[model samples]
Target chain A: MHKIMFVLLCLLSGCAAQHNNIKLANQLQQEPPEKILSILSEKEPDQSDFAQYYLNLGYLQLLSGEFELSIDSLLKAKNEMLSLQATSISENVAAGTVNETFRRYSGYPTDRVMVHNMLALSYLFNNGIDDARVEMLQADVEMKKLAQSDSLNGQLASTHLLSAIIYELLDERSNAFISYQLAEKILKERNISLPRGLKLGLLRMSDKMGNDTQYQYYSKQYPVLSKLKQVRQKKHQVFGLYFDGVVSNKVQQSLAVPSFNGKQIVRVSMPAYTSVQHRDQHNQINDNEQKINSEVVENVDKLVREDLDKEYPSILLLTTTRAIAKYQLVKEAQDKDPILGILANLATIFSEVADLRSWNMLPATIQFSYLETDADHIVVSTNHQGDSVVELAALKQHVILSTGLSDKVFHYEQ
Target chain B: MKIQSSFWLAIVASVILSACSTSVERLDAQQQIDLSGAWNDTDSQLVAREMIEDSLSRAWISKFVKSEGKDPAVIVGRVKNLSHEHINTNTFIANMERELINSGEVQFVASSANRQEIRDERADQDLNASEATRKEMGQEYGADFMMQGQINTIIDVDGSTQVRFYQVNLELISIKDNRKVWIGEKKIKKLVKNSKLRG
Candidate 1:
């Protein structure tokens, strides 16, 4: 009877904590940019939410066109992320024996990779091409390092794509082709069809290099390429457009896995975006705030799902082991004493709280398009609403947009 | 009580472990240490010493001194960095400058970046100081030869192993006749084996 009572108490407490956390997140989402920045600044280093707060704050500042401030905040976030990733044996033991929630919130691999991407974008947004180039190179180097450690991720394609664009703008067509080839291979291996813009880029590069066979290969792969001819030194070039939206939050999912006796139910909290197919949804974009031809390019949500699927086996094994061990401990206690049994069950439930921590401010979907016009200035809009206006002084420009409430715009010219 | 004590013990252990940090030991500046196998002070120092020794021993130094009956004035030009890494080319240039000046075989002039500042100070001195101490403009020594260089790095990485090759090539060219006086090159190769776990 006491064990039953203890279980009830534990469940109530866990539920309350979870509810409060959700409330905090929702509050943060609704808060103003200045308010978010101030809150993040006020947070102490010892606070559990310090790292997450900075990530949110950095992203907020990034969207507000405060690139310098964002760089500072993002660097802090990077330091925190690094420390969290360096998990000691003691932290591991605590998580296993006491409570998984006791461990520091090391962000998901995707979250860490996005931090580098955002930092690079932040520099790019400020028109610091050299610094942006450095950041992108660093991002590629980091992904390579992660690959060496057998860590599979989804951001490699995006990073390579960004590098290719930067190289193209800098008039390094050969380098751009190399990055584009890498991106194409990664996407192909992941079974994702190439984006129209990427195919066009490959087609243009092959044509420029005078590789007739390679140009023919891409031309066949993308039917749209045959309709659009490659134009290198035109008076106006079609610039690429990328739209970003908020990534989905985490939710708990209960899975039944085979165990020692029968099957045990375990709760695994994962990014809710991973379950939803975002490719079907199209974001409406206006060039210079006017309706124009646009199409969906890349959905990061699907890539994230593919990465999670690759790690599902390990997640299942570890979660099943934890569940079985807890069940056995509870059963042993019940055999010893009824009160002790209740306490053990209570401890297990409270300790088994899923690791729901992630970089929630990331975009759920990333869409791309190519706009060809003679206008030197264009106002970008999403969903029939004007977001931000950009000036294109060069022949080629790369535009980035965060279609969230911030409605951020960053453009690069060459 | 037993369970409560065990829980507290675990918490205490975790706190102590989290607080622990790696200890560091200081070493001699000249001692060579190859961590990460990237460029380091030892490599920089080695290249500096060798390049300086080779440059001064060239026939141009003797020929110029014999013809002009004075040490040839030299200026350091822009040292282009065409490598993958963001190396401080200025540091390498400073090393070369120090060695060339110390050898007393050649006179040194300010770099283009420094010449503007030096001239501005001289102008300021002319306005603010006594005439005797006021340095006159256009009295500066013109360089007989300019030393310029480029640093290049090539890296090949496979799995947990990587090989980095760095080549630094410097040229001493006669400003008057547009003739190449001396060319010096130094190469370094490092085979770095990073652990799979750490990479």
Candidate 2:
């Protein structure tokens, strides 16, 4: 019995090579994106954890201005996610016997949606407009499927806004209008205010499509529609996206209760989110004629917290069941042999670690701004990263993507 | 007894290693192998063949030939991929070009990128090649029609099962008159059911 307990302890220890994602998240806040990207590139993640690994690596690659590499990594991550969607009997058994971390990380619904969103942006940065449009269509399908499953799981306003921008760039005004409306609906559903760019896009598309009813309705709500005339007269339309500070990390929370008449401890471990105070950076675009301040389009911090809250009950039940089973095993061993009981208790305590893996490299908030101008170039600035001069092509539309965590700025024009 | 136990362990280890080892088998290029049920070369080649055949059989080709009194010249245009997958439309276009050129019924001209390269080569010939062998510019055939199309897909996924439907639409438009002379379409549907467990 003692030898069996020793072998079990060795197996659990071998499987307990947990990644310190919290430390990596902290490093991402302090270090430059390129340095962190190189570090991530050097580290080989476990085979089952490739989804989470590639998600972080792809986002970092995007921030580091490796658009092609970013697209490749994001695609691999997407494939990994798709393959992991199926229920794995062996993983389930391991999870029940050992810990939840033994199972593969089959990304959350929000992560799935964001993967397509990031892929769209990466394709855009690589000047593949058609590919970007394809990503938008895929994102729409994913969001629809997620909505059918649960209304709130994949209602990401940023994705819709990005889709609207891509559609408008492709000269599909009708689709653009629908995307803007979808973004508005999601924001309204979440009780989040609509960004300025979304409002302007809706009004512009509605007017262009000759939807008098929608135009009139929005005109009454936001008098800013009156400026649509002047905006339409401009020769260029510029859209800017800002990715703010790093998202919060998931930490392990442990609860130990004395059971079996205070002889053994039943330890329940769970993944939790500690409240993190992120810096609120002001972002904007300047075309020398007017200054447009970006507004929050998606609050990833809030979305991640809500996702964890929804999964809390299931995680709690699993942890409790495992804890009870471990306690019973300990009691049975003690009834037979005291040394074996001690060994079993030690193994149980050491193996009861929470699964703390997540796509923690995401931005805290995604912000957006729209500008209509005839200027040849625009200066985009954030309170954290200094100003970047973006030379607009002679095209009618352009998209400028920047992140507060990096100095790089990616531009897509049409 | 110890030798027997060691021999059985070795046999078991060999079996496990063989199971885990990678194996490769060469197969014919035309053989259809469906894995993951996404778009593949087989779909591209088969779609191109069927669509080009349908286009060639239409009345537009004979009408253009009879009116012009010669084989009508054609050029390939952009084939946009609007599907969810990152499909290389280049291969599909190449397949179509090969079929149209090999059919010998219509004249296929260089595409825009190829036209530029040929023009550059001709200019270089003027600079370096012998006078008789030098190719002249401004004498290239101008295509009467341009072929363009887009690939679109509709995917429905439930749990581990997915139904993917792809639609490809191609059009041949008169370069001078801006009239659509020929329209072609091809579709493919696949159902994929993933295993619920991994070993």
Candidate 3:
């Protein structure tokens, strides 16, 4: 009765969590950008919907002149968006969609583009002219191709408007003039009214170009563009949520076993948890950042030096080791098994660690990340010899997560 | 025999426990971070390092000396994204820029992001030059070469077992010559699966 009650309680909690997630998603979907952003910031949830919520909220923030907050929310969604390929943080990042958007990362693109365009426009809108210019060029070249084929013409025209703004920033009056003209043309052709505040910039731009006729045309149309050059230069803010543990492949698994024509038997398994400990030993890893957790790092260090050497000795076979571990686990009812999905997430965590350490040592970019503990289940198995002449402990099984990268065929040169 | 065996068992168990406890060290914990170096891939990093080294070795560039010459040339054209994974080319190019500046090979156009940052930080003008002065520096030291590239992957599977492949291709094109001064490619591959554990 007690066991049944416990099981029932667990189910009830899971359902409640699910319910909350649906409510949150519905709430974010309906709210205005400011309200959406406020809600996203107020609560941190681990579900994909929450991350998506933040991404949408961030986009709205960018629209409403809250660049710093937009940058913050976008960065938050990015860190949480697990699948790699889909997240477009930038259009240039998205152009690789055909070949680059791996099946695992596909979920990220929709949300990815929201922040990407916002950042681009924010930079362009506020007058980070060159940054905006490159972003616009990249958007015009990379994203426009995709957006045009799709039914998002208004956004596409807006992208062009931002690009024109970039040209204006560089004092490249010609390019700016042409782009603005194109934007105006796009608005008219698409049958979309010129957004209320947009005409003033066109007027200002025409006046700068000394095109009296064009200037007169725009001057006659109340130019609402404010003279203040906006700079979406707010520093990103980060709030620590859950430190969700993730597993992924350490490097592109490329150590292929040479096929022995007939004699040698080769064995393989799904894949092993990339030992994160190996990332720092041989080459210099840039970990000289000022802030970091000491205890956790020390634990990682110990695991690298000792556990990795024992389990994955140089030139070792992951299959044999995991098999032995699995057999041991089964004998003792240990739940962690290679078949269970866990190793991949662990490898991804290590990869993120390696990437983070290296990313920090460079020239400063407006970047921030927060670490918080979420949840993870660790499975373990033990094995004992059943009826052997010599007493020997057999194996141990553990769960590992295989990054989705493992399944998809990657081909660059065909 | 049982007593001796139990004692040995305890020793082994203790060793195993201790070993597992300290499995990460110099291998897991990095000493310092140089985010400047591209975190994209090891093989690609090596290739860029070598190509930049090669460029620096050239006699013309080796001899050219400048007190504060920055801003090189613009990128010649688009770089193909060849790899299966979408890698941000900026991650790698940014490193190349730092190396160029460090070696004093060439300069880069101040990305508006960086330019804006500089201006914001130095709002107090007497301590630093104004925005106009900085923009002038960008023109004085224009870029000479543009770096771009792609990443690709390959996989071969025999029944359930498989072999995976990865390659990153990069090229440094000279704006003046329109010539591909340097092209570098790096490949990585892995094998997975075994029937030994089949039920």
Candidate 4:
């Protein structure tokens, strides 16, 4: 008996397990798979076959092997079914069909137990097994709470199967197989055919303990499981994203990989990305600046600022070969910008200042990147090439790098 | 008396003619050259400035710095000339830097090229024995930022007019933070009339 269910002595008239079956079926416009799942699970069941919509939609994504997203949708349907399974109590109990709360949900729409089992199976078989088991654990925790109230619910084999897969992955083999055996027994007693690979594994374990008939039975079952596996392989399509050679290196940089030393190292400093920088940029103001309202600011100064040199955070270093330098200037020597003289003069002053300041912000501290084209890597124009037309179109390619750091120089990339 | 009068007038006319022509041209052995209009050096500067500023715009430096990030005080560093020609990208950067700074959105660190002038001024400020004693200025921090790069150019001529292209790139790095925070690029194109090629 499912513990969450109750026996109503008074039969509510016309409710006949058709609680929500009055609506017409309609399809939704294309949307993110997650949304479709939610609408299906939340709609009234008997009045409309909303559950079927979820089931069919989820099936398409699942069969396509978009496991994480597919499972998310399936779980929504599972949640709806579980909620519908809850019946109003009459302070009494019944057995057998009375505990079919899953079927008796809202409209008594369909055989929902099968749906739960299949979802559990799908979660286990598809990608990210651990994620699937996390949901199953939540179900178990909820089911346990219900049992104390009604005493009708018993251990569900589907939940155990999910648990077994998780435990096996976690290397708690003994517990995993114990759960697996319980599921096999419950399934067998229901006269369901045990898939052969699983049946064989269990039989082999039993046979090791001297169970002869069990060993022989599952050995025969192995061929069928093997065939099912082959069919599944043929039915499923596998797609992959391939990055070759230097291209892979570029991708790694954009993704921000940590260095071999297992330290966070970023070559190009995007200090603004840090929460501390955000606080500094948005919150802290110099005395010279005018004051603004406090509420207008986001609370970001809460964290302490750490030195970046010591931190060595992981970084994505983006590079490009297809780079062009173009400018627009109205030249006047008589009115030659006094600022130009000042700007040029900074170099000489800084070089001398570097000696006085012992390599402070003086000079030599400035870093630069080179624009490499087929022509040359020259930094300054001798004559008038910088204003050339058709610079960017002639670019070769771009290099996006995930790079490591060192005390001496920033590594090109790892 | 009539012959003497004609001689005086002729002398006056010669003086006026010499005075009018002399300021306009200077003798170089057998030939005289004109110094008015544009000098080769000024042309060098115009072409260089155009090239560098063009590089800056194409580099899209503003798009990076002004993009929802903290405005760093950029300091101008070395605009070295590695080419045979006298390359001056600083003048180009100065214009861009002013635009960046004056927007009231950005700040520029004191240039490295001016550090000693600052120092010598500070040094001149010190007390000395003589009434004519010069003061040495006190020291200041290295610029909180540095912006510097190079400019390269290509030129070709079709008769009197020439086509030229220039690229100038600048990088801004913070001193205290040691972060390369900004990059600016600009390129210049021009058609200049060549007096030497005239018919």
Candidate 5:
């Protein structure tokens, strides 16, 4: 009986491994990105959690300006996510018997699409335009697949806008127009107001593609399309992307119910998000005469919350069943011996933890702004950092990516 | 009780040791081995071989040879990879070059990078080497046609099953007239099913 209790305790201890992940999430907010990256890089790959590991590592590497390494890590994460799409019987059994964390961290729907988005950015930063185009097409395929499964879960406006930008850069005006249209449709479906940059892109692509009716509709509605058209031939264009603060970390919520005539305690644990306060901050880009503030394109916090909400019912059912099963085991042990019952109850209490694992290193919101200028460079500044100059040189198009966590700015030109 | 403990301990030890061990095997390179079902060497080689074969048999090569009174010089240009995978287009281009050169029907010139290196070597010889052995710069043959292409793929995934369709398109364009003299296309489709259980 004692041996059985010891084995159960050991298994429950294994379920508590996510405490380290929670600690790491806390560390991400305090430590420098390079230090955190070094720590994550030193970790050996956990086969079951490999996707989550690489996902976090890749994002940090991207923030640290390691474009090539980030691309490699993100690709590995993508491949692992693909392979893990198949249901694992053993992992399912572990999930049912132990805790939800025992199951592999096969990415959520948002993660699947974001993986391709990040890969596209990584390729663009590395000056691999053709590879970036491939990632955008893959993102489109991923979004379509996600739409087939769940109508509203995987549609990301940032991905579509980025795809449109890449297509326009490649001189594929027709594809660029389609992508811009898709981005607009997604924003409309989600009830998110279209940003000026996206609106301008639609207007420009529509006018270029000879869609007079749609162009006229937007021009009438926005009234700024005329001004945008006037500056269309500005010799150089700059697009600014700002990744906001880290996304919220998931915390465990436990509910205990007395059962078996108030003798046995049944505990149900589920993952939940705590409200974050700094959700509205954004970065600003400035030239000598004008200042452009990035508009929120994707609120990653809301996407994560929506993803969790969609799966809440199933999670509740499974967690309730597991809790009841665990309570019954404790009751049986008590009927046999009081000592065994006490030990089993202790194990249950320790092991009944929610799966708090997530790709927590992602930004809370992704913002975008566009500027068409004939100038050589522009100044970008955030609340936490001073102004930084981004040189455009003679490039016809340029992209600037910055994150709130660091002052480092990554740029690419074409 | 002791026997049971020993037996369990042996089982755990064996499992750990087995997992820690690594194994290696060698086989013929030409043998087709599909793992993860993404694009591989076999697909690259087969596509290059068949596409080049089709391009060489077309009327463009015979017409060029008859009109020019010699085998037309060819240069391999950029073969863009626009697929989901990071395919090494260089290997595919090299395979096509090998096939074209081995056919004994066309002349193959060095690519841009290789030509630059060769030009540098000739310039070095002009300054440092004896004049009797120096190679002239302007005597090099200009390519009559350039081979350029792109690889594209469409993947459809359902549950544990995925169907990958790859389309490779190659075109030979006349350098002087900018006319596409020949176009060759090869398509490959694969159906992959992944197992749902792990040991």
Candidate 6:
């Protein structure tokens, strides 16, 4: 009888499962950005949702061309993350009694990196290049923190590349070269192969700085670096678009753990985000025969998966312990009285909700493209669809056009 | 036992309520309080004091006083902010102007924008005010020297550590000979601790 009860209790406590946000994710996919923003903005900064709400609302605002509002929301999300500390007894109790989902929304590391990246993009779109540079610098700081503490191997290549582009815009070649080198090093460390555009940038910059040795080194390293064409004399520009697909949704997993007696079962639910296929479409523009292919520059999904993988062990242990304790308590109540046992069992069953919360709006992948164009008017397409024909009158001479879900262009000369 | 538990809950509620109540206390304005690690009034005042002291100690002021037999007519020029942070250079500029004017060692003239406003008022006086008090526009005192400056910053960050270095450079140029007479520079470095948690 005791063996049967133990089996029943173990079966009652389920393994961790994902909290499903497929409905919300579907809304994000189908609804217009403005509508989504309006709906999400209503619940922003709510105590229950806290960090994730701001994260989603801010990104939605970014997609809707409200750069300032997006920064505001992202900053709020950042503040929430900063205010959270190591788990306290209150949090532990809350996780046990209510659910882990009800616990404080201390954000994931990747979420923070994305916040800074989005803020930089916001500043860049609003013609605040200097502010954009600062935001990118802050992102680099955050990345370094994660790398040092979490033993993450790579840097945020996208943010660093953006910083390099900003430096290039300001005509600060040395800073740009250093940023590119950091991006290259981090990407290599993380086992991500160097993209042709980045290698081309490194090669051209070193050559211009008269670093013949460095230029020769990269040329030999990339071998294809020699074959890569450069349009140096005429002023040309490249547009980069980064698209992040829908991130994995969280789902609820119910496990039944056998109790101390044969007749009883304890059911537990935990939330998780399962990895899925990432569909990324790149955008590129061509002027004459010089067209730069769009590359998948950053994979945000992989970073998120790595974070989850690191935390899974601890999370599982915590869930299992909580389940066991609750099951034992119910068993003790049953030994006392039938009514008390029934009440305890009912309470556990009803409150066994999985913490199914995440920043559901995050894209799984980040894609980028480079175009060499001198035209004052250029039509760039992403996902084989032309979103907009960007006017370059404001960005003549040298231009850097960047886009995420929406597109932005910057044109400046020193 | 139930009554005792109720009493404890009531006490806890009151404590929480008291904690939530807002309270405000005023502090001295001159006190240096670094909150966001951004440029603050203390920085502005410190730069103003240092730059004024350095500028007055330079040979330009005494040389002008010796050569022309009067205090040099000085005017504030453009103070450009080339730093990554959005700093209002005017805050410190006004502070320095106050220090220079109070020193009484330099005859401070109106900057071009201020002069324009003065000219506009003088023009108004020409039409509306008494003839004896009507001020002439072109007869206004021309500055012998102009002070201009630029604010530049360099930031280095690693993990949770950030070091921000700021350099403010001011130059007093002779309008007649276009010779730079006094160059005053103030540098500030701050080691700021950043929150390692990102989101």
Per-candidate TM vs. native? 0.76, 0.94, 0.33, 0.23, 0.94, 0.81
Q: Give the per-residue lDDT digits (tens) of candidate 2, residues A139-258.
A: 887877677544577679999999999988887889999999999988998898888788888888888889999888887778855565544478888899999898988888887778
Worst 10 residues of 6 chain B by lDDT: B190-199
lDDT of 2 by residue, B113-153 (tens): 99888899999999999998998888988899999999999
TM-score of chain A of each: 0.76, 0.94, 0.35, 0.30, 0.94, 0.85
Q: Which structure is stronger by TM-score: 3 or 4?
A: 3
Local lDDT at A320 for model 3? 41
- DockQ value for model 5: 0.59
Cα misplacement distance, residue B5 of candidate 3 (Å) = 30
Q: Which of candidates 5 and 6 reaches a greater DockQ? A: 5
Per-residue lDDT of candidate 3, residues B1-199 (tens digit): 9999999999999999997784544532323343312134454455456656766665444333442243344442344443323356565666556656666546555654666675665554535666665333232344566667765555454533546576657676766776776676666675645342211
State which candidate has the highest lDDT. Answer: 2
Q: Predict model 6's lDDT versus the native.
A: 0.71
Q: Largest DockQ belongs to which candidate? A: 2
TM-score: model 1 vs. ground truth? 0.76
True-vs-predicted CA distance for residue A333, candidate 5, Å: 2.4
Ranked candidates, highest TM-score first: 2, 5, 6, 1, 3, 4
Candidate 4's error at A239, in angstroms? 21
How many angstroms is residue B122 displaced in model 5 relative to the true structure, after the best TM-score fit?
A: 2.2
Supply candidate 1's per-residue lDDT for A204: 77
* lDDT assessment of candidate 4: 0.36
> Could you give the interface RMSD of candidate 3 in angstroms?
15.4
